[model samples]
Each structure stands twice: as C-alpha cells, then as structure tokens.
Target: MTPPISRSHPGLRAVFELAEFLDHGQKLPEQSRSLLAQALQECIADGFDTSLFTALGITQWGGVPAVKKIGLLRRDRVLRRLRSRIPEWASLSPNAAAKEMSASFRRYETTRWPRERHSAKGPAAQPNSIWWGLLRSELGVPGEKRLAQILKAEIQDGFEFPKGPATVAGTGEHPENTGTNIR
Candidate 1:
C-alpha cells in the first residue's frame, strides 16, 4: 500500500507532534484541547484517521491552520457567524448535524486545500460544551454554565438536538467517542 497524500509542510513540527499524540492515544493539557483539535483536523484533512480529539476549530482562521493559537481571536465575527447559523444548526438531523459540525471547519479547509475532502464527521455541536461555550460566549452567559445547562436552554428555546449514544458512556472504548462524555 502507498502512503497518504498530505499538504502538511515538513516545518510544521507542532502539527506532526500532535499527530503522534493522537496516534499514541496520549492526552495533553486540558486548556490545549482546541489546539489539539486544530491539529487533528489538519491530519484528518490530509488523509489521516484522527478521531481522537474533539474535531472543532476556530472558523476565523479562514482556511489556514494555526499551530499554537488558543481562543478565537476575532470574537465578533465568529460569534456573528455562529448566531446566524442557529436555525441552520438546530434543524439538522443527528447525522446531518455531525456532518455539518465537522464541515464547519471543512467549509474553510476546502478553500485552502481545494482537493482535500474526507468522510470524517465530527460529533454534534449542541451537546458539546466547546461548541456551546464558543457559540454563547458573546451572550454574557455566566461562565459557570455547563453543556447540560446550555443544551437545556437551547431545548427550551426550541433548539432541541440529538444526544450522543449512551452505550459509549465513559468506557473509552470507541475512538470516535473519545472526547465525549455520553453518560
């Protein structure tokens, strides 16, 4: 068998190391999840199987991958896009939501690497706190609000979404469900 084609540059040490992290099933500092997510996303785009980390990234990066950035830099515009997509987000079926959520990054990724495409869909956004926190960051929401609380609010406001399977509850058995807490 032949090796996979990738747009990753040799100088991108952080990205490669991150790839190793996923390959080895190692975790990093809690605060660095997004950066890890960004790296895993890059690898997935490059034809690597990387379902180890949460597959979310800042849409503000346009299409280029950032090696070390933490939070969303352009809060106003990113938050605007997130708000504008609420109805679109809420209306998706479970499978479609996964595809769409993963494509949130893919939508930009394709612009940079035109030929890059993958069948890897991410977990849904509504039940994921990373998505909720980033989405509601501009709403003056209390920082203490967890994903359950945010999801409850979303449901109360008619934005009900599907939950992750209960079968994967904290067992760490499936790679796709690695970053999720289904219980």
Candidate 2:
C-alpha cells in the first residue's frame, strides 16, 4: 500500500514554498490574508532569519509542529533582511517597506529589458511579456525610490556600486552623483 503523507511534511513544504517565493521576488501574503502577519512584523523588526534558518537546519527539522515553529523563524529572518536593506529615513512599516523594495527591484529588472524585446514587434508582444510591460510601468520607478535603493545599498554595505544609474536627459552624471547623502 502507498504511504500517507505525514502531517510533519506540510510544514516542511510550507517552509520550502515560502523560501522559494522569496527567491522568486514575490511578496508574502498580506497581513489581512495571514493571521501570522503580526508576528512576522516582529521578526522583521528583529532582523534574524539567517540565524533562525541555520538553527532549524541543524536542530529542528523533525516534524510538522517543529517546522511550523521554524516557519515563524524564517519569516522573521526574511523581514529582517529586507528591513536592513531599506534606509532608516523611509520610516514605513516593515511590510510596506518590503513591498516598496520589491516594487523598486521589479522596476530595476524592467529597465534592464532589451528595448527590442519590449517593442510591439518583439518578444514583449507575447501575452506574458505584454502583462510584464504593463506591470513594470505600474511599478514605475519614481526618481526618488530608484535613488534610495542605490544609496541604501551603498551606505549599508560600504560596497562599491557595480554600475552607475542610467543617465537621464540633462540630469548630469545621474542624480546619484550630486551632493546627496548616501544614507
């Protein structure tokens, strides 16, 4: 006879699903959509997913209840990583901040698309590409949000920029280079 799926398996499945969702640049369920959103807020506030996942892998992977417990750990860690990446001046809730960051990143991704690919005669003419173009335009990078990601990543890591922003008309050296605070 075939074996039944263990109760413990669902938790592991959820953890894996959540992790993959993050990897693919999707947002977690909304606070209203999830009872756990409040707790997630605290995890984000604390900034500890990497450590929690480490602990789970090493010591807590036995069953569903344990996995569920670890989900909270992972969620918090995800929130924390996101919060750390955002600048302090934004002063938004962690969830909102994460959503903005995701939107901003999506915009960055869109701008990287080849113009030929997005042209009506190009790959973007496909149904999927068509939807993507629409979504990208909606998430549309405001000058400020784009600048914030560049500055935040630079200031937080003390890392050199991989590439400078695309220059805008008459903007001169990209707005990123003007006497703005990196913070």
Candidate 3:
C-alpha cells in the first residue's frame, strides 16, 4: 500500500487553514460564492494543465483539486473585501476577526429574516421579504431588544448613515423655499 500522507503536506496544511476559516464563519458572501462556483465549473470544463495542479501542491494521490483552489482564492478575495470595509479588521487578531465576523453574521441574519411568525403576510408585514414566511421559523430573533442592541453596537462602531442630496435653495428655481422642506 502507498504510504499515508503526512499532515505536514502543503495541500493538507492549506485545507486545515481553510477549515479553520470556515469554522470562524469567515465564509464568502452569497454573490461571491455563486460567481466563484460558476467560474470553477468553467475552469474544470476547460481542463487546466497538470502543471498548474502540481504548482498548487496537488497530486494524483490526494490533494485539493483545481476547482477547490479557485474557490479558496475567491474566498480570499471576499475576506479581503471584508477587511477593507471594516477598519477594525485591520488591527484585529485572527481570533478577534472571527468573533467580530460571528457577531456580524448574527446581525445580518436578524435583519434578513422576520422576527414574527404571524407577520409574514403582505409587503409591510414581511418587511424583510415576501418569502420570509417560508424561512421565518428557521431564522427569527428571540426579541426586538436583541436586534436593537446589535444595531446600536453597529452604529457606535463606525456605521454611518448614507448622505442625503445637498439642498441649495438659491441655486434652484425655488429660491423662497430654502430647500429645508421635509416633503
């Protein structure tokens, strides 16, 4: 029988690192995951050179395939985007980043899903989505207070509201209006 591969193998090491990243909830965003999946399928159909696999430390015996490598690269790109968007990520250690990402994921889930079972009907009722009913039981917050806490923390931690359009009263035709009208 062939000798068992050691954990010291580069391919194995990379896989372990990826597993740790996933365990920490550092997953790629839905859009990025979809795009990367399509790209990987295309790459497989195109048939990459064996040398490419060799360069990535993948062998015929056992190692990450080209598709997985592509996926990992795409995930890394998403992680980079996350780091850029959250300034705190730049200074945080790996464990801290993981904790932050987990909290962010919880907040995202709370916002994306409805909090009430009966409030799944109609547009306003299903504020998150019309299909919220289907997934309501799967992802509802225990209470509004938890969501409020998450929002408060996010706002205090550098989340900024989008800027509104500038209102120049004199420059516009409505000179008397001063552009301060709420309507």
Candidate 2 deviant stretches above 4 angstroms: 1-79, 88-90, 113-183
> Which one wins on TM-score?
3
Query: Each model's C-alpha lDDT?
Result: 0.34, 0.36, 0.37
Q: Write the per-residue lDDT of candidate 2 for residues 1-183, one digit (tens) a residue.
A: 233333234333444445434444445445322423443554576785534333223224444334444433332332333345346525765445645655654554566444433443213222223223323333222244443444344222111122333221122232223311111
Give one digit per residue, the lDDT tens place, for model 3 in 1-183: 334344355544454344333434444445445444554565576675434334434443335444444333323332333434467754665456655655654554566433533442322321122123213323222233443333233222111112212111113212112311111
Question: What's the lDDT for residue 51 in model 2?
Answer: 45
TM-score for every candidate vs. truth? Answer: 0.19, 0.22, 0.28
Put down candidate 1 lDDT per residue, 1-183, tens digits, no spaces.
223213232223234344335444555444355566666777779676543222332221334333212122222222233433568755655345445555653343345223322212224443232232333332222122231133223222111112221122234232134423221
Assess candidate 1 and give its TM-score to the true structure: 0.19
lDDT, model 1, position 50: 41
In order, what is each prediction's RMSD in angstroms? 18.4, 18.4, 17.4
Per-structure clash totals for the candidates:
0, 2, 0
Residue pairs with backbone atoms closer than 3 Å in model 3 (clashes): none
1 or 2, greater by lDDT: 2
